[model samples]
Target: MKLKFDSFLLALLIAIGLAYFFPQAVLFQDGKFIEAVTTVGVSLIFFFYGLKLSITDIKYGLKNWKLHVVVQLTTFMLFPLLVLPFKSFVANAVQENFWLSFFFLAALPSTVSSSVVMVSIAKGNVPAAIFNASVSGLIGVIVTPLWMSLFLDFHTENVFGDVYWGLIREIIIPVILGLLLQRYLGGWASKYSIRLAQFDKTVILLIVYSSFADSFSSGVFRTISTSYLVYVFIGVSVLFALIYGILYVLTKYVLKFSVVDQITAIFCGSKKSLTHGSVFGKFLFLNNPSAGLYFLPLMIYHAFQIFLVTIIARRYHRRKEEESQ
Candidate 1:
């Protein structure tokens, strides 16, 4: 079998390189144009997310309460707990932000599209995968901010209120509008899911470009050395492996779920969403020049998870085929 590379990952790296060479181009006429475009793009992405969300599927998959519980807890609780112990090790503002970047990655929801795709590839519980992946984003809208608030002290006097307000305006409200219109346009959304997914990625690429541009322009990355970046990348890879291993043990032994559910649990629970990270980072880290740095670990984790899960999914696929044969 041949190895496949993710084109979007390549696109992201190219976006960063373009940002480095042409940071000035990211801003046109006081930067208002690009900012407005990205803000609207972020809202529309979530609106489409709500439009594609299936209430019936969620209700149907509710029967697998144990499976849902394990996935959600691992996503919202276990991942953060594993990283929380390192807070004491952070000694400076720079280190704190870097550590917070990892924490942010830990707090994020699982990827909706990739989780379901991987589980399906492994012949796992598809409906449950769909349901868990969908519900995880909704849960993240609330829980992720709460996790950040515990450690982050914002520059604003009304920081807490501002955080939720931004979330409500940029994410929650758009999702609600999409949900309300789902019955009318949901079929159309489903019909164009592939196109819509492409749109989602375009917006994410734009966000990545703008963020790195701002960081480069502001000279934020100069503070971070080459060795530090290497450590961060390694830490992200290790974090992925640790979570994957723990979820595998939990689903197979502690929970004693079926092989299919085990596959779903491990895949879903161990993944993180770059889409959500981009949108949520915009609101949560607004006006922070080093925002791109916060996204570094998430970008790494996103690429790493997809690559690793694809390999695992293929192995599982082969094993099932062998058993049947």
Candidate 2:
């Protein structure tokens, strides 16, 4: 078998490089034109997300309460706990920004598209994957900010309220609008899912470019060494492996789930969403120049998970084929 490179990952790297070289072009100047476009883009992304959801599918998915519970717990609870213990170590060995980045990565919800796609690839519970991944974003809208508030002292007087309002405006409201209009738009949305997905990726890339531009302009990357970046990569890789391993054992042996459910658990439980990370970070870290550092780990984790999970999904796909044969 031949290895395939992810073109989006390449695009992401290019976006970052462009930001570093042409910060002025990408940076949001006083929340002007670029900001307006990005804000609308993000809202539309969620709106499409809502349009794609099927209430019937989610209701049916709820029957697999055990699997749903495990995946959500692994995403919101276990992942954060794994990183919390390293607080003291990170404080001593790494910068506060990096520690915050790692914690942010841990606290994010699972990716909506990739989790479902990976589970489908492994011949897992597709409906459940869809339900879990969709619900996870909604849950993260509430949970992730609360988790971050525990550590970050916001510059605003009522940061939590502001964060909630941001989510309501940028994410929740648009999602609800999409849901409301789903009856009329659902068919079109489904028909254009691939195109909409490309749109989503493009919006995310624009966000990435803007974020890195801000960071580069502020000279945030200058403080960190290449070796430190390597350390972060190793740390993120280990975190992914640990979660994947734990979920594997728990789903397969402890829960005694079917192979399909096991595949869903491992894939869904072990992933994080860069989309949510970027969108949420915009509001949470507003005017914070170090915002770029916060996204670094998320980008790394996103790329790493795609690479690792593709291999795992392919292996499981092959195993299923052989067994059927």
Candidate 3:
């Protein structure tokens, strides 16, 4: 499975490389058609996310109410608050829109499938991960916008108010409908989960490509430097480690959960969803040219978390082996 994931990632890299090198070859170089394709890809991602989620699991997930609340609070509230201070330092170094973009990234929803997948790989509590992750998205509708209103002072330039409803319609509604339909098709959804997840990943890669491609084609890259972004990337890495590390310590002394539940709480608690980051950026920063800049931290962070957690998950696999011994 690890080998196959490496292969999939390699293929995705190759696909992105092609988009980078031959920008014209990117499906629909014309902005109108490309936008349509982007919309479709976004919808597909949410639709599959809905299908992959189970209705029965949701009921069971609600039983662990405390875990869900903390995870959401951290993802939507505390994480954003933590980044607010850094804005003053980066203010002179980075552009306002760029700073706004990253600030918005921090407030977006937590991931669902990958969080649960990481917990499962680490032999953690799958059910709790599912519930906490799902709950974040549902709560994000209110939380995300409120988070934006705090920092979003310039309505004319950012146009966040106009774009907010579009995003809620595109991403949120589909996910809720998917959850509601779970009773009828949840089993079928499970059977095809592997295929659907791959499809979803493809959609995400497409989003990444289109996002960067749009910025590249518009000459947005010229305004930014690789060195500056490197610093932001480092910030993202440190932030990722900090969140997971804090979760680990809290789970140990505070949560007092079993090993599996601890791992679930840590991974689920530490994550911010890239899919939501992308979808929201499209809505939240529509007129803003540096949309990709905001997501830059998160993209790097997402890639980092996925590979790093795999290593951590393997340790748990070995621990399970020793316990069985």
TM-score of model 1 vs. true structure = 0.96
TM-score of 3: 0.87
Worst 10 residues of 3 by lDDT: 1-10
Off by over 4 Å in 1: none
lDDT tens per residue, model 2, 46-78: 999889888998898999999999999999999
Question: What is the C-alpha lDDT profile of model 3 across 1-325, one tens digit per residue?
Answer: 3522555556556655665675564445456676777688777667667867766777887887767766777787778877788677655535665566667767878888789888887888788888888878767767787778776553675565566667777777777777777678778888988888777777767666666666666677788777867777777777887778777887788877778878887788778887777676676655455555676777767777788887888888788989999
Error of 3 at 195 (Å): 2.4
Give candidate 1's error at residue 3 in angstroms: 3.0
- Give the distance in Å from residue 270's predicted Cα in candidate 3 to where it truly belongs: 1.0
Q: Which ten residues in a row have the lowest lDDT in candidate 2?
A: 86-95
Lowest lDDT 10-residue stretch of candidate 1: 151-160
Q: Model 1 Cα displacement at 171 (Å)?
A: 2.0
Candidate 1 residues 1-325, lDDT tens each? Answer: 6668789999999999998999997779877888899889989998998898878878888899999999999999999999999999999988987899999999999999999999999999988999999989889988998998887775558887888788788888998999999999999999999999999999999989988999999999999889888989899988988998998888888889999999999999999999999988887887778888999999999988988899999999999999999
TM-score of each model, in listed order? 0.96, 0.96, 0.87
For model 3, what is the error of residue 245's alpha carbon versus the real structure, in angstroms, after optimal superposition? Answer: 1.9
